[model samples]
Target: MKWPWTLQPFIFYPQGGGQNGDQGWLRAGAEEWTVTGTRLDKASGVVWHAVAGELPPVDTQLSGEVDAHSRLRQMARHTGEHLLAQAFARINPAFEVAAVGMRGPDCTLDLRGSPSEADAQVAEALLREVMVAGPLTLETQLVPHTELGRYPLRRATPLTGDVQLVIFRDTAGELFDVSACAGTHLPLGNLAAPVTVLGLEHIRAGLTRVTFRAGPEAAEYLGEVYRSARALAQGFNTGVAELPERVEALRSERDRLAAEQSRLRAALAAALVTAAPVEAYGPVQLRVLSLPDAGLLPAALSEVPAGEVRAAVAGERCSVGSGVPELDAGALLRAALTVSGGKGGGRAELAQGQTQQPEQFLAEVRRAVAEKASWSYVCHSRR
Candidate 1:
């Protein structure tokens, strides 16, 4: 569960205001416990450190060490969100900061009103300009609740007692932002290098969520993207800048080849149908044929005269069509597949299916047609 640290002089920051808590270790003598997360009990005003392993004695004088890397990452993301929110506000007055999320690797800023692609681009440009303007000065101040109106706040403060305001100013003492916040932020300097927006999506009807990354995290992402692009370009034997053009060219060639292939298949189907010989079985005239491509089955069957029954096989695929009402093509094909070990079905006039045993499938169709059409036994035996 959690260990309460309410004694005095706390070093760990608890999870609050949408930012994650400090993660580290607490040790007293040789006994140590790992703190996975920290949270505040708002009702009791107690900060609880969630830990693993055994808990130390209540009075043990344990010292804690916060994980510096994680803290810095959290700080960078939180600061970047603040600056980006202000940038959006400057772009349009309607784009108010509705909410902020800093729990995960990527932070999100939710704006009150939806913004177009152009508006988002302008906001990102403004943020880039602020990031390169040298180290900014951050000032945290405690002011009476009623005196909050003195400073220009980006939003109304929720705190009822003394309000904590984080103020940002450029080198020339020009104020950039003043907002009431409880989250941990970078004490000073740039809001990490290479802060950029990832993308945007509509969270609701009027709200838009902007995903972004900053500092070391952003650098790592950009590095991976560059490596992936280089690998793809090398596979295509082209430079990274020319990869898109090469891909478009390949797609065009594929379409042209597909159209030519369709034309060739139609010609082959017509030739196969014309070459097959028809055999007379009592009142039924039957024609059997084999095709090279399964896709040509429909075209071949369509060429058969209305006076004849046709059965054709292409690889594992087979089709049977009955022109005479005495033979049911659907029932005939179903019986054949039962012995051939594959599956398909169609109407009585036309039926198509796949079977592993092509010879056995065709023989089954021939035998069934002979029996259903009342062909002379001597004639069936001769065929």
Candidate 2:
């Protein structure tokens, strides 16, 4: 589109898919108009904007205004994509740009190749050079299809008639890429600010999707991430740089405590076996051990002899651990289940169960263990 002032021409084809539409005002002398949307009119071979409010009369000196923030971000993402594409080209000459679209605060360039870390690094370096140089120049030209073969054009389909191309050049007049493009672009290297690569992904076997934010969007995204990390550090009373170490320390502490609890349970299991009273269904081991903070039943079970000891522990709730094989422990656990109605299962050699009635589970365990000795019996009360 033509601008009244000495401004570079803009092709309204947007850049990225994830980025949003551009919004800005249009000014013609005293009257100011708002441009709500922009689209390519294929029939007319021109970009048309959906203008709001009254527009200036035809041939009036009018200037198209773009959202500075949005434009800056678009440039950053677009340039970043160029850098990434250039890097991929260096790695594999066969790799080429499939398509490009700029949206919102980001831009996406679909590339055809499996990019490597070296390629990414090269792209980053190229992007850094653009940012350092600044103020890009974009020139558009129409060349005949016959002339396309002379330039290093990356296109799958053959061109017919005349084709529109965008040429990106830096302050030193170094050419970046010359391709048929419809998106708006920054002058040469003048991107308002540098672009940063946020992330990259392999979208398909042969295609790569690079996600990047530029200018204010990049600053904003990074700022939020920093704030979260700082808050986490503050919560742990540590420096921001030390947050990772602090988290690792907390994890290590938890693991150590778990190991200690396991050891204590094993010792308690041995003690419960030695202090049981003998009864009819083998040694009726009834030991009301004060439950530790963890794994009370397994600890108690480990102490008792196999098939001879049936133990129960009372804590925040009640739990049963037995050493008897082929016994329907569920049947024995029914009384505990009736009071609290919790369920659990394990191998025949050792079964465990939980119930909310911590006080009543001890009496229930004693009764359930005494009644059954075979595998087929179901715990009628449990159901």
Candidate 3:
């Protein structure tokens, strides 16, 4: 239900300008309603409180309480966003805010220009410096729309009538920022919680989105990151500081071992190919080899004798190679696997696939070879 109580003395902050609405409870006599969210009717200039429960009688006196802790965090994030935007602006004027969202777990701001890594670093550093410099005061003032030119705003506003200016200044009364906004804000001192940049990504053409967290949320995010890094480092038997080096070393060692294994497989394949018996069938020579290592299949197939069709099987995988231009290795293998109900394909010179029944696949290949070579002559020899 909508509750139009904006005119009365109210503590709830209506949702506007990228800030979340206040949530709490409203009570009158023995009845109470949970204020889920508050929203402003921008077109009508009316604030509405969305409630969950029975609606109270018109003009019934009611008391409301805002969730102070949640409000405080929200204020911190809002002010932090202002500080971050200012820092980025200081780096480059083109880094103007195109859009913003702060109602979710993490706050985000879309910038008009793409910021480099160095720009982001400098912006973060500047933000940190301003944050820890000293206690800064955040104040608001209602100014006529005509007088808005007196303040230098980071972004332009389309608001008419009275504009609420959220201003921040240092302890020495030096102005830091002034913008037209109705969102809640906190003094820089009260918002001394850590701020962290989560990441930056290109959301669209000529626009970059920056995701970040502030206050207790940022502290929690940092804590989780540390815990995950520590766990990974412990697995590698090293400290967090040495984790990256340890991972790189392991990758290098893996590559070295892989190269040595490939060399050994190639040598063994050459020996196997040298001893393999060739069967003669009419005008064609055929060779079938069953290898223990699938890694050796490619090397073994590469050693095929001229004018011979070779098929090698390792585990479930099989490879076929042909040196004769008249015979199509891929076509033969495709027919054989088709008969055995397996799946594979390749070019005329080479083909590869897998089958559950290796013996059946080999038998099909042998039958196909016999048909192609005819029954003119048959013999076996190794040379």
Candidate 4:
């Protein structure tokens, strides 16, 4: 039998402007060969199929097989992009489809102008309509430059030579977009599922980029997004729709609690001063009290009278004095209180210190301050 390579007529080229070419295997008779790669020759505009395994003679015929899965993805994405672009033209007549490019997972169209939210919604609605319209017919024809002015066709410049144009027509006899595209497409419009516009970006002053997904790929992307949202809602113990509200409520409660803490600290400081007492420190009068806790120290210091009262607490002592400016009262108190291995210091007249035994601390500080005053008195009396 003559070589049956011509029986399989499907040929894929790697040089598709909108998408990359397909890759797979080829079989002829009992021999199987692997198709390593494919590339489009710019010189001849024909696809060069690279294969591995045994090579047939130069004129030998072989069956060509393209990867179906890859082909379907490209078709869905490319066609979906066209539908989206048509919608853009409908919403804004000034918007022009600048360029269309395709990759494995998705396709992109550069628009001459940015679109608003309303424009995007209209585009999405039109895509839905195309998906429901069923199979689409693809026709490629070479028309004279003068004839191109009749349809909504995009042209860069009149071709001096033969010009190739690809047109897409839906089942309703409605034309979606007519452009000079050299990409593969589905036979029927319904082959591509309803497309979802993933995102839009303003690339430059007048250019916008739109990305979209179609068919099973669209379904899978949406499924992943919903799953993540559900997991987050469960972790926060709120309905998915109420997450924003719940977050705001928690923030408000935290602020309220912080204010309450500040008020409590102020009240405790005031109460400490009300509990101090007056006593004699040798010749001068001093107010000495062992504070119930360190929390009361601020309030106790605030209550001491200006000069007459020299106050010190043994267990958690902080003192402020109004009289006896020359005495290093704070230092004296810290030193006397240090017998308990506690540390404290303040200014000459106002000092604070802490000790383990509150009673012993008060007694030591009082005796130390008195003794020091006595030494000063004796020295002054002789002079």
Candidate 5:
């Protein structure tokens, strides 16, 4: 259920404008409610809180707490994104910030103008230079909407009410960037170092999306990569730089072993055909076999004796065929499949199908065969 903000100063920012809503606990003396989610109403500019347990009475003096760790991490990454955007614009005058996202540990930027890998590397290098170059100063100002044109704004202002402008300035008071935003951020964008461009992916017609990480998350990511590289080098008894050749060799060896295993499986299936017992069923010689691979049926049947009737069940798949042209093996297969909830069709001498239950397939085949044998006996007695 939703709790309206009219009764209290629910100053907690609701999830909107690319920032996630705050999550924490709201306490009133001895009772506390866990706030799991929060949302904002665009039409009414109202904030709503989604909480667990019964909310305290209206107008109850509740103490609210926000998860500062999560908030600060997101704030730091957002500031780093602003720095990256500013650097890109300085390097390429035509660069435009199309869309940006910095939530949790994910930081992504999409640009209408395509940026090559080299261009991204250069932008990253420029960001690193400023990272070491003293912390930047930030100032916020509130001014009338008509006076927004006096500064070099990133984009035109859409809101006419008192707008908040966040300005990043170097130590010398020169402006790094002037953009209108309302999210919490660090005083210096460079404080969220060392920001790096992960990679670039071509989204569509001239648009490229760049993924990046900043602050502690970036350090953790690079540490994981280095640890994995060291582990691989130790496992292969080679240096990290020679890992590519060793990995390719291992892949080649794996493929060769897989091929060898397949050849052995096929040979084993064919051998089973020769080992099956020959049984008499009225005028026909029959050999029923169960195997693991249904695809091996054709190869196994190639070794069957002439004039022998065959039925093979492998897992949930089964097939039947006869060397004797007079015997309608296809009919027998269909009759068996019916009992097993399966489907099959072929010439009167051969048929194939799959069964719903592999364990019941053999029993169904035996019943169909016994019924056919009984009918044969009745027809011969009438003759």
Candidate 6:
């Protein structure tokens, strides 16, 4: 069910103006209705207020009020749009207002042309000039389309009947910008406070969108930027300008420490090669050593004499090398535990690969030694 209530002396600005509707409360003595939004019908010239809860008595004297803070921000943005359009033209005389919108605290204007960085800066400078200028008074009134030719209109309007012409005039009544518009604006329909040109983005072919913030929104954005910069500078013990240099220095120091730590770890792990348990089989000494560093495995095998062989392991990685000319430690290691999706490859005397079972790899090394020595392998099982 919808109740179309007629409000008198309405403070709510209906949703148009390239911005959202005003939100607030409609009161009837003790009972209150929350106005969540307002919608205006351009065709019927009727305004609807979307509210929560049941409707109040008809013909009941009710009061309405808008969210004052939000209303001010939106008014400032609407005012900023006219200034931006004129500023954009100052940079490129041929530019046209392809689209414009005011959402919350942000305002955007899309022009139908490419705008370079320098062009944006020049426009932004002009935009700020109007934003910071002395109190602006908008001399606007309704005028027929036929009389548009008398003034220096900013753009042509398609409206056939009476059009609302926003006149930029001086105290002496000299004209400046004259454009037809229907959106809500400041009393003077100009920036109430300074504005910030957030940035410009090339959306696509020949369309450049300029985003900006005005009044309280602009001041808040600048405040947040300064606060963040100060926090970063304080944390790094440097000025904002030197922040990049300080960060680079810290990164270099971290890399140097990591490299030094790796060298020390590899040196300490080399001791594991000599610590491995050895099995003597006539002429060959078979050593099995498992360490945490794979790079140190090659150095460990070098510790073995000319007639010895070593199988060094680090995590899932394995390395086998033999000083003996006849034994292929590479083939022997792969054959020991070729189970469970494991694979290996190397020269006849050395091989390095992954193994699921380290103990199985060691067993194969021992078997190769026993077979070479022609010794019968015996399994001792406890009964």
lDDT tens per residue, model 5, 1-383: 55643324665667765667777778878888877767777798777888876667777887888767776777778787777888888888556778888766768888767888888899999878776676678889997888999988865568788899988887667888888877767877776887878999998887788888888788888888889998989998998888899999999999999898778877887688778887676666778888877767776655445567788888877888777655677887777777778888787667888887755766666666666666776787899
lDDT, candidate 2, equals 0.60
Candidate 2, residue 130: the lDDT equals: 65
Candidate 2 worst ten-residue window by lDDT: 2-11
Q: Worst 10-residue stretch by lDDT in candidate 3?
A: 374-383
Candidate whose TM-score is highest: 3
The 10-residue segment with the lowest total lDDT in model 4: 1-10
Which order, best to worst by lDDT?
3, 1, 5, 6, 4, 2
The reply for model 5, stretches above 4 Å from the true place, is: 5-11, 239-383
TM-score of each: 0.72, 0.61, 0.76, 0.56, 0.64, 0.62
lDDT tens digits by residue: candidate 4, 84-140? 777788778777887777774556778887886667778888767766766567777
Q: Candidate 4, which segments miss by more than 4 Å at Cα?
A: 1-10, 28-31, 50-60, 133-142, 154-164, 234-383
What lDDT would candidate 5 get against the real structure?
0.77
Error of 5 at 343 (Å): 9.5
C-alpha root-mean-square deviation, each candidate? 5.9, 7.5, 5.1, 13.5, 6.6, 10.0
Q: Which candidate gets the maximum lDDT versus the true structure?
A: 3
**Count: clashes, candidate 5:** 0
lDDT of 4 at 148: 70
| Candidate 2, residue 26: lDDT | 70
lDDT of 1 by residue, 1-383 (tens): 66755534568889988899899989888888888888888897778888877777788888899999999999888888777778888888799988888888788988887987788889888877876776677889988889998998888876778888988887678777788987777877375656778889998999999988878898899899889999999999999999889989999999999888878887888777778887776667887888888898987776456667888899999998887665778888899999887898998788999988888988888777777666544556689
- Regions of model 6 farther than 4 Å from truth: 1-3, 8-10, 131-133, 170-176, 188-191, 241-383
Model 6, 1-383: lDDT tens digits are 35376464466888885888888888978889888778777787678888877887778787888888778887788777777677788778777888888976778988877877777778878756654554467867888888877877777778878889876653345564677887666776345456678888888888989888877788888899888988999998889888888889989999999898767766676666557677887667788887876766766665445878787778778878888766677777677657423678888778888877776777776777778744422321221
TM-score of 5: 0.64
Root mean square deviation (Cα) for candidate 3: 5.1
lDDT of each: 0.82, 0.60, 0.83, 0.67, 0.77, 0.74
Q: What residue pairs are clashing in model 1? A: none
Candidate 3 lDDT, 1-383, residue by residue in tens: 66655534458888877989998888888888888889877798777898886777788788998988789878878987887888899899999999988896599989988997678888888877776777678889999999999999988899999999988887678877888988888866337457678889898999999998888888888999999999999998899999889989999999999999999999999888768887877778888889998989899888466789888888899888988766788998898898887899888888999987777888888898888766333322221
- Give candidate 3 regions above 4 Å deviation: 1-10, 29-32, 46-62, 189-192, 234-238, 261-338, 342-383
